[model samples]
Target chain A: MEDTGTRSFVERLLQLDRRWIFLGIALAVVVPFLVPGFKMRSGVVSPRTQSIYDTINGLPAQSVVMFAFDYGPASIPEMQPMAVALCKHAMSRDLRVIGVAIHPQGPLLGGQALREAAEEYGKQDGVDYVNLGYKPGGAAAIKGIGTNIYKVFPTDLSGRNSATLAVMQGVRTYDNIDFIVALSSTPAPFSWIAFAHEAYGAKMGVGVTAVMATDFYPYLQTDQIVGLINGLKGAAEYEDLIRHPSYGMLGMSAQSVAHLWIILTVIIGNIAFFMWRARTRG
Target chain B: MEPGEAVATGMYYLSGPVIGTGVAVLLTLAIYSFLYADNPVYKFAEHLFVGVSAAYGVAITYHMAVLPLIIDPLFRPQNTPSGQPQYWVIIPALLGLMMFSRFFRRYDWMSRWPIAFMMGIGAGLAIPATVQTSLLPHLYSTMQPLAPMAEGRLDLLTGIDNLLLLVGVVCVLIYFYFSLEHKGVFGVASRVGIWFLMIAFGAGFGNTVMARISLLIGRVQFLRFDVPEIFFPPSP
Candidate 1:
């Protein structure tokens, strides 16, 4: 009777309400922030993040780097920190940053990141930076820009003539730009690889959501892209490298706690599954 | 408090930070409510997300692409050809309009012309790029020297990693080769391929988990740190 009772309990445990897991995750996220003097230390930096940092570091001052924002608001959490860190790093190095987005919502997000970073560095707009705004046509637009920037974006996001912007001077195509850093959550990275890098021989790098990061490993190995930054972890690593750990560090602690909770649930659930299976077999 | 004072208090609460926090917190809670069970709040939030996103996309497309590229060139005065209308935009404008023909029963066939034109251009662009960027490079990288040189000698660790990668690639390719039957050596190779596939999938899953957890952490940070600092400051 005791054996049967224990087996029933194990089975019930396996089938417990998913809300329990949700609540656990909630507490895991909340408790860390509530705690005093708790900070998540940055782990060993990946080769990928190091490579991206090196590429940006190597650029000459005032050299243009096109920051392509190809993500939407839904992906802001993962990509925003990356955007901020990259822009911050670039501005600190005195690199001329040109912001553009293939996705509609990307420009709004990208513009915000640019403004914040430029403000920190006391950089002037139309001189040190420019937001070319959102362009349409996806891969075709990338191709057009790579060929002739004027043909693609006749005006900046603010409806100012592209020809008049001081940043636009001597920068008409990918040929003039030093490097391209594409921040994307979709197949936009592949499109950049296919169109911009291949056609124009533009030196490219990518910052992608963690899930999409692995897919770009091949491109990195082939030297098609100079470097890669993978999701929030990658952003945190960059932030740490630049000595400006902000939201990325905070997010990392919560992420680590939440991950531990999930891993624990998985282990417990697996044990219950195995116990139930053994009982059924007997 | 006086009625006038109450009105001022209400106006202060309606400022950017307060309204932003209130809406964001409410929406976040509504979304999170899905963990318990499907509810009206969750559904409302879901619909709002989709509807707002769609409208935003349309508005951006019109503002960024359609108006500037097509409408303005056709209607507005421009430097092209002595301030004359570009007129070339008419061709593309017609093609784009034809896309709407699919909505009508009889005019459905007209949509096919534009569809074919687009497909042809897409295929033309994609084929060479696929070969150069993805397919050819993939093959080239996969066929790397297993014995990597390190300080004028073959490095054991690098060689081992390379050998394993080579084996994984070859086996996986063999597994997909339908012409061969899974017997003896073929079966063993295919089994090894399955193991490699499982490892790759496991790595992918780990990455996906990291991404989802990162997004969750972002929201948690906002609610915990950002919202309070912005909207509900502690009294000095």
Candidate 2:
């Protein structure tokens, strides 16, 4: 009778409704935000993220750095913070910033980042920064910039002629640009490396979603890319480096709790499965 | 407050961004309703998302690609920096137009020409670049001094890491080598390769979980912070 009771309990655990897990996740995410001043421990900045920070930090004032916004709305949570942080860091250092997009929706997001950062720094448009906007070709567009940026992007996002913009004064090709960072949720980094880095000898870095982070390890190892920003953790790390806590920092507590919840569920599910299996075998 | 001031405040609440945020919050909730169960609200949200995405994509393509690349350059010459028509732009435009041939069965073969041209250009660019940037560099990096002496002292940690990397790479390659039957030492190596592959997959899965959680946190943030901000505008 005890054995029967044990088996039934194990069976119930095994057949637990998945909605319970969903509710648990929701609570784990929400409860963190409710606690005033809740925050996950700031992580050690990884070598890859530090490399990017160092590169940007080491650049001289007014040196042009192109940020390729190669992601869309779906990646806003992960990619946008990095974009904003990079923009802030670059503009704060008084580095001349240029924004371009390969992804269709990239310009809007890039423009937003540039505008926000520029506004905070009191930087003027057409002088301190310019958004070249989206171009059709992926790798070809990058390659075009290597030869002549004006031909690829004749006008800024606001329709100001490229030649007339003060930001474009000395910037004619990739040779003039100090660094190129591709903030991507796709494999657009590979295209940048191929056309911009390999072909034109341009220095490049990448900011990618966590899912695509592993794929860039080989490139990072080989020095094809200077650094990598991996997903939200990377964004948080950047925020920490810049001393500007924003969305990335805010999300960390919830992220940590959610992860713990997932781990708990996995353990529970596994234990229930094993118990059921042992009873069946007996 | 006066009646007139209250009326003005009501108008202020119905501003563009406030209304947009309200709509966004509704759509977000509709989508999140799927976590409870598959329902009409979720389906409606999904359909709306798809439709909006498609529409946005079309508008952006027209604005960014078609107008600037084709129409402005070829027809609206004054818009060009040189203030002269780029007649050469028609060639690429024609090639782009050729892609539409795939819609008709009889003309599908014509689509092949543009496809072939693209393939040829892509291959021509990618082949050399890949070999130089990816293949050669990876090979060179892998073939490092396994046991390096730093200032006349052996670097054990560096040596071990290099040795493990070399072993892992070789074993993984052997696992993919189906030319010979797996047995004895080869089978053992193949098993090791499987372990490595499993570890890689596990790491990827973990990262994927983190990415999904971050997305969820983003939505939650919108609900908690953004929605309230929409209702109560912060004083400048």
**Best candidate, DockQ-wise?**
2
lDDT of each: 0.87, 0.92
Q: On residues B1-236, what C-alpha lDDT tens digit does candidate 1 reach at each position?
A: 55346445665466676787889999998998998999999999999999988999889888877887787788874622235577888998899899999999999999998999999888988899999899988888878777889899989898888799799998998899999798899999999999999998888888898898887887888888888875755443
Give the poorly placed runs of model 1, Cα more than 4 Å off.
B1-9, B78-84, B233-236
Candidate 2 lDDT tens digits, A164-212: 9998898899999999999999889999999999999999999999889
Q: What is the TM-score of chain B alone in each candidate?
A: 0.88, 0.93
**lDDT, candidate 1, A1-282, per-residue tens:** 999899989989988988888899989888888899877666888888888889889999889899999998888889999999999999999998999888888888999999999999998888888888887778888999877887788777887777778887899899999989999998898989999999899999999999998899889888999889988889988898888988877688877888889899999999999999988998
TM-score of 2: 0.96
Task: For all candidates in order, state the fraction of native interface contacts they contain.
Answer: 0.69, 0.71
After superposition, which runs of candidate 2 have C-alpha atoms over 4 Å from their true positions? B1-8, B234-236
